[model samples]
Target: MPILVEVSKGLLTQEGEREVFPKIAAALLEAHGLTGNSFMTPNVIGHVSVKPESECFVGGKSQSLAVVEVTVPAITFPNGQVAQKFIGEVTDIIDTYKAKPHPRERTYVVVKHAVDGPWGIGGKAYSNADLGAAIQKAAMA
Candidate 1:
């Protein structure tokens, strides 16, 4: 089965869209041993989208955060443990990029998944520690 990975909205700064996305995508491709036109293959598809934040005022004011969505196919292994390992591997990549210092201060990185058929993997909200742990676990797994 194919899997989709999506980045959450408001998770990325403008700089992230232009800089982080490509680097992350490329890292994923390399990790999977995929290159060039291989990104078009059916088993995996990586996508990125962004939504603007909104605000409203009622009795109180509420603000909506912008989000960035990244979707990629999930790679399955023979067992649950292996599957988790695979997820961990991908998660590590996202974490690494999230930890890198950037020019913007209002940026975050998250992972999410699709609920129905053609299910996608979501990168969870990541901090440097979270990313580091995930990377170490995946690498050691």
Candidate 2:
């Protein structure tokens, strides 16, 4: 799984720049009820990038914006409600990290589901069932 948090330069405070990645990653794990799980916790990978405002645009105009793209297994986000909550939480996380005067409307979040066959790790493609087994195995450790 991969989570990308991209923001226009100056969108986040200096401290936020250093901290938001882990915070957003934790939010994702919590949303999936896998927070602190030995297996899942180690698997949630993320990246945070700051882009120059001159290179960032919305509707053809330069804008300071935040975009969060999280990719997960197909079995995740089982329903609209779950997806909605996660989206809102991602926005809130951004709001918490935003520099003053950064508009909440500029925050964007997207959750993409990768079909099970391609969810590979350690040279092995992991299906949904394999993930479940892995999680269970870790829990028993």
Q: Which lDDT values do the candidates have, in the order given?
A: 0.40, 0.85
Candidate 2 residue runs with Cα over 4 Å from true position:
none
lDDT of 1 by residue, 1-141 (tens): 222333434444445445554555554444444434321323234455543333322235333222233343333132565434444554544444442332222323334432333233253454334433444555554
Candidate 2 lDDT for residue 49 = 94
Alpha-carbon shift of residue 82 in model 1 (angstroms)? 1.3
Evaluate candidate 1 by giving its C-alpha RMSD to the native, one decimal: 12.3
lDDT tens digits, residue span 47-120, model 2: 89999999899889998989999998888888898888888888887888788677878899989887766567
Worst 10 residues of 2 by lDDT: 113-122
At residue 96, candidate 1 shows an lDDT of 46
Cα RMSDs of all predictions? 12.3, 1.4
Which pairs clash in the backbone of model 2? none
